[model samples]
Target: MPEINSRQKTAIAAGQKVLNSVNGTPKCLVFTSPAAAAWAQNDTLAAGQKIPAGSRILSNCAVSCGALGASVTFDLGLRHFVTGAEVDLDGIASNVASATAGTYAANNGVLVAGGVDSVTTVDTEPVLTLEAANPTDDIQIRVEIWYLPPG
Candidate 1:
């Protein structure tokens, strides 16, 4: 249940509810770290792997690295947060070459010989453009977020 402030209770007793109706308020908040103890999801995801679009990823009250690095290419569609969820693309498309971690990096920072990183200019919504690499390499990616109903 949603918590009602004291003011709301007083208003209710006085017959002066703000919206004149009692319903849960639709709300949103961005999180960079993990959620509280109860915010954990029971599902478990493997590390440095590409999770198919429909698979569910969750945080376990601790900011554990969800997906590793993956290439967000035009052919594969932009990594989506899917309506009704919050996704954190901390190392989206990061390239860890020999470390077994790879991502889409557009020739920036220390990138894997054939890998690149996905870029995003905005939070909540991420738009990634993967760079093409030689025949010898592959891309990797990881995304972190909480699912929520789209507003």
Candidate 2:
């Protein structure tokens, strides 16, 4: 007689197989500017980090102004260090005074390709620009990027 596996065992094996099909894990990259002076300035968050092809990226941003009645704008994106061509990720325009936050993701979680990925050998990083209009006040901006690697 041949031995048979239980129903519970069969289900557990199937679940494991499904999980194994999904490769890589979710990772996060963060960029912050403390005491950013009024006016326009650019900051680097992560630099020269290896990101495999076919990976997806998402970003979130938060800003706080030192004084009221001051408007701030921020642009976040990925920049290729060698080519200097930026892939725009998200933008926060004229945020309210005090504190505000925003979240952004790629179009339907599309994978990174074309020039966004490293053409040579090294990896790329995220860049953020903050622009403030009027008054002399310090602003703080924080950006977070979430990505999933390919299998």
Residue lDDT tens for model 2, 6-96: 6546777788432211334777666555555544433333434444444555322233333322454444555555565654433222222
Cα deviation of 44 in candidate 2 (Å)?
Answer: 7.5
Task: Give one digit per residue, the lDDT tens place, for model 1 in 1-151.
Answer: 9976775578778997543112233222223312322211221122222333322122111122223224212111123344413344223332322222333222222211134322222223432222232211222333332222222
Instruction: Report lDDT per candidate.
Output: 0.28, 0.43
How far off is residue 112 in model 1, in Å?
29
Candidate 1 residue 42 C-alpha distance from true site, Å: 35
lDDT of 2 at 114: 30
Candidate whose TM-score is highest:
2
TM-score of 1: 0.18
Model 2 residue runs over 4 Å out of place are: 1-23, 34-52, 59-69, 89-123, 132-137
TM-score of each: 0.18, 0.47
